[model samples]
Target: MSGRTPSTRLADTIGARPVSASAVVYPGKVWDVVSEDVDLGRAGTVTREIIRHPGAVGVLALDDEGRVALVHQYRHPVGMTLWELPAGLLDVEGEPPLLAAQRELAEEADLRAGRWDVLLDWVLSPGGSTEAFRCYLARDLSPVPEADRHQRDGEELDMPTEWFDLDEVHTAVLANRLNSPSLVVGVLAAHASRALGWSTVKPADSPWPEHPKLR
Candidate 1:
């Protein structure tokens, strides 16, 4: 053993290897697929194909009654209408994750939150994609004015909003009834954070250094 204490151990390491060469292989409407030759020091150089994404944000809107807001939206790629937290891609340049979460909450759920906290941050698929994700805990919620609501289209046009008890959602997630990544992580994180008196949550404006845009 290196004699390092368990408390001194960090979860994820933050570092980058040198990329000898890189190029986009497929340019898509939302994201792009790229190939890169990375130098791994003694391990030698290796090539990797990656899906370059703009990252995304999700909002766990908790009402005063402890119900969590959710939306049933069609995900064409998955071929299912998933129950998900209000979420959207970070495609808008220069928009902060918190703002993105707020926008998603209003647009998808027709709700706004007065209190926001960073609940969790994660990478969707570290080995295959550059998709960084952030989930926010939102409280003190209120409905947006009817006239101020965003016009929905495509998969969002017929989306339905619902609220469920946090514990119920957590149980559903563990039972495999819910599969949305954001919903799963958000509910589990919310339960754990609540157990710790919400000390696990960070400020809404906390810096997300791991996000591709920020890095």
Candidate 2:
């Protein structure tokens, strides 16, 4: 009744594939793997191990100066300290994604945004893992005072955050220099949304069923 009407109901299209059995194969600090016997229409039933992730949120913080904030931190899995947007895991039970994004932006980058909206949602390596992400576009930024900023530790202690012009981020995306999925998608989506007069952006509290938590 307010902005854009909700789209078609996409649920129940695919009937649930009967899960005969499931068991936890491994459990880690962040995620858990469970093996399941899943029914396949023509292929019969098959056993598969799926990684269950708690989901994540990425914040594309942009200042009124037209600069995008970025952070450089070590990614142990890839053995490289890559540049990325302010992001974090959604491990807290019952915490809304928008609130999580707000907390992450403040904690990781010492920044705050007055306006927030859904940029995009994606599933990374859906074949093996349930690592889904919701990226938010944050604007009208303000810097938190150094004295009041959150204390850092681990990789965060050494992580450096900086702002780059929108053109610079776009160029980096085109040059394939920025490898983080969240950053790349955020940049492209932000560019496209702006071109469309920001009509594509949804409210910060928009429902996201693809974000694993709701699924």
Candidate 3:
């Protein structure tokens, strides 16, 4: 074996193939369906359909008492009401990821954070979508002022908010009870970071080169 340990060797490989043709097949409300003909070096060229998304950010708000803030919202695609981290799309032009996470925390959880760290970054669905997601570990929590709270609408209206022990959430994740991607990944990443004394956490504004730029 080489000198690289598991920690040093564990990383996703990145490469790009030439796309001969690309077009938007379906323009949806939130995202678009894209079709592309990519040139494979050795293998023959292939056409792929992709979901072009605007990306998103999530916040795992941890209080000093070892509890996490979560929101119960209905996801129509999955047809389930899930306990998930406060999260939102990066739809607003020119808004930073950290700012989006902050806004989501305040809007969905009615909370704010004084300190933020990047907990995890992932591709929501690499096989079918260009949706890059980031999760933040937010601490030094405080309630959003009532006057400044965002007006909830649609699925957000009447959404319930609750606090749960981090351990409880972790157990739920392990038991397959929590199905929200953000909540599952954020909770597990937060747990691992905490176990490592937060040494694995990155700055809230850490460089995100993997996130695709939207036109």
**Clash count for each candidate, listed in order shown:** 0, 0, 0
Instruction: Kindly list the per-residue Cα lDDT of model 1 for residues 73-184, writing each as its tens digit.
Output: 8888889889999999999988877888899999999999899999999998999999999999999999999999999987788889999999999999999999999899
Off by over 4 Å in 2: 1-16
Estimate, for each residue in 29-100, the C-alpha lDDT of model 3 and write its tens digit: 999999999998789899999999999999999999999999988888889989999899999999998989
Best by TM-score: 1
Comparing 1 with 3 on lDDT, the higher-scoring candidate is 1
Q: Candidate 1 deviates by what RMSD?
A: 2.6
TM-score of 3: 0.94
List all candidate RMSDs to the true structure.
2.6, 4.2, 2.2
The sequence of per-residue lDDT tens digits that candidate 2 reaches over residues 97-197 is 89999999999999988999999888888788878899999998888888889998877888899889987899989998989888888899988888888
Top candidate, metric lDDT:
1
As a TM-score, model 1 comes out at 0.95
Rank by lDDT (best first):
1, 3, 2
Q: For candidate 3, what's the RMSD?
A: 2.2
- Decoy 2 TM-score against native: 0.90
